[model samples]
Target: MTESLHIVCPHCHTTNRVRADQLASDPSCGSCKQALFTGHPAALDEAAFDKHISRSQIPVLVDFWAPWCGPCRQMAPAYEQACAQLEPRVRLVKVDTEAVPNLGARYAIRSIPTLALFKNGREVARQAGAMGAADIVRWVQAHSA
Candidate 1:
């Protein structure tokens, strides 16, 4: 039997079962017919955040940030590049603390530009700082490995 993975659709929040080996082939969602991985971080609200973090079989990396934070803005491009390089193996998401204050409070996020890595519905690693794309990739790989 082929192994499968549950991938939450970034566009419609639908859960999809995809063959593990096919993740890099650019799968599409069954419900919305949208590309499952768009090579960019998904912007998530509280509800969507909970769904993806809890339901996805793959590890999730969330960047908790706000619109007005200079460090957050400065790191946006690096984060985007990291997403492109990290997808299929990981799901990268962005939560705007200003829009979803409840999520930030729920996670006890004390700083903007916090990177939290979740696996099996729990946080496994967290970092509070701005990093370049290479550093972001290295840090995530180090933690996830």
Candidate 2:
């Protein structure tokens, strides 16, 4: 049997089961009917963040950042690029620390721009500070299970 993965819909926050091999086929959410991977990081609030991290079968890459931070603003574009490169395989997301302080606190995020990789309902790796698109992609690829 072909392996399958549970991917949370970035649009409606619904979970969908997808065959592993069909990842590249641009799957659509069964519930919301929206494209599963939009080639952009999903901006998740605390509730949505919890649902994705806990339920996603694929890897989850989170950018814990604040709007006022200069480095966080600067890394936005690169994070978008990284999202495009990594998505369908890894669900990339951003959580604004200022807007959702509890998530930041829950994850012990002390920095403005922190990248955390999670798999199987737990964090697997993390890096603090800003990075270029290539570096972000490489770091995630290297660390993700």
lDDT of 2 by residue, 1-145 (tens): 9999999999999999999999999999999999999999999998899999999999999999998999999999999999999988999999999999999999899887999999988999999999999999999999984
User: What is the per-residue lDDT of model 1 for residues 71-137, given as tens digits with 9 covering 90 to 100?
Assistant: 9999999999999999989999999999999999999999889999999899999999999999999
User: What overall lDDT, based on C-alpha atoms, would model 1 receive against the true structure?
Assistant: 0.96
Model 2 clash pairs? none
Give the C-alpha lDDT of model 2: 0.95
How far is 10's C-alpha from truth in model 2 (Å)?
A: 0.2
Model 2's number of clashes is: 0
TM-score of each: 0.98, 0.98
lDDT of 2 at 58: 91
lDDT of each structure?
0.96, 0.95
